[model samples]
Target chain A: MVNREFTVENDPRILFGKRLAKIRKELGWTQEGLAIESGIARSYLSGIERGKRNIALINIYKLAQTLKIPVKELVDI
Target chain B: MVNREFTVENDPRILFGKRLAKIRKELGWTQEGLAIESGIARSYLSGIERGKRNIALINIYKLAQTLKIPVKELVDI
Candidate 1:
């Protein structure tokens, strides 16, 4: 199971990253697989999953599409 | 007019803060006034406006209530 310590209450980036990682794992996909599916750079997706990057809104939309999740699910609205 | 340079595409915290600041200005409220209305600390609200803090989701709801805006408006989805 993914760590639940990082939450939207603490840091949105971490919360997003963790949720992305969880969803990726649930789909049995690697970061590279997600990157390819989302049409984003592997390095950038890696950085995003690690909470090392500020993902753009467009990319977030792409990620939501690739992950088959709603954009609201990806963001903590 | 508030600066439109800071957007959900750049930084969510800044976007939220900017929106909050805009709404506060529209309501003719100072930071301290907003703090009193929102039941949050003036310093914390100031920090939030300056993008110096990561506000909690509960507090976001409080801010939304105080600002009379939708909670979704405070966050980028």
Candidate 2:
């Protein structure tokens, strides 16, 4: 049986996507705004937000910088 | 002109490599120890430490877990 909690807790992509969407919404920025600020394509950001992409460390740093949050805020579940 | 400081500051790989090396040493763990604990190949860990690899989020998460540091500790410059 799959340990759902463990799965949820350990999946960085899901954690990142959820945090990214929440933070973006909290900041009232659209995907386009965030993408432009982070220097990633909007479609790519969309994929990341949906947990469909395996984000690179550089992009994670860019998003953290652009969102003005510690990268911890996004990754520490 | 190349903003050397800015380049150094924003390069996550370099920052990560330095921090990883520092933390690993602080914990008295060798690269082999860290690689085995983090489930990454020793060769790949070496590559990452040299900043020649674009580490993925999963690997960063794995390293953070094995190191007992927040993922931010790895990615934040």
Candidate 3:
């Protein structure tokens, strides 16, 4: 079987996901709301928020744009 | 074919790669040198510097750490 335990608790992707979720909540936006605004699939956003998805830079930029924040804000801890 | 034209010239990944290459050059470091400093494979760094690969967040963090900059500095334009 292929190895399945790659991601650990301190993964940066997970931290980024949590930060996205926090910002979305701060703006009173739901996952669906932010997904539509950011032009990403809601399911995909959910995975990102859960730190299970390794999102691309474009999507990260889009999220920052939708949130009206700088790209560094989303990417940096 | 598996959608051969997936990447475009204006893709964010490509832009990110260019930025990484520029910073590395500003520091007068070779790709091999940056790769060793960032704890990433030289071949992989080459792909990222060329904007052909969608690098993971962990690797981005590692690059920022190696460069002695904030994660946002590496991610933001």
lDDT of 3 at A3: 22
Regions of candidate 3 where Cα sits further than 4 Å from its true position: A1-9, B1-10
Give stretches of model 2 more than 4 Å off: A1-6, B1-6
TM-score of 3: 0.78
Per-model RMSD to reference: 7.9, 4.1, 3.8
Clashing pairs in 3: none
Candidate 3 or 2, higher DockQ: 3
lDDT of all predictions: 0.69, 0.80, 0.80
- Evaluated with TM-score, which candidate comes out highest? 2
Lowest-scoring 10 consecutive residues by lDDT in candidate 3 chain B?
A: B1-10
Residues B1-77, model 3: lDDT tens digits? 12243356556677789889988899788898899887799999998987777777778888887888888888875
Which candidate number maximizes DockQ?
A: 3
Estimate candidate 3's alpha-carbon lDDT, on a 0 to 1 scale. Answer: 0.80
Q: Which has the better DockQ: candidate 1, or candidate 3? A: 3
Which candidate, 1 or 3, would have the higher lDDT against the true structure?
A: 3
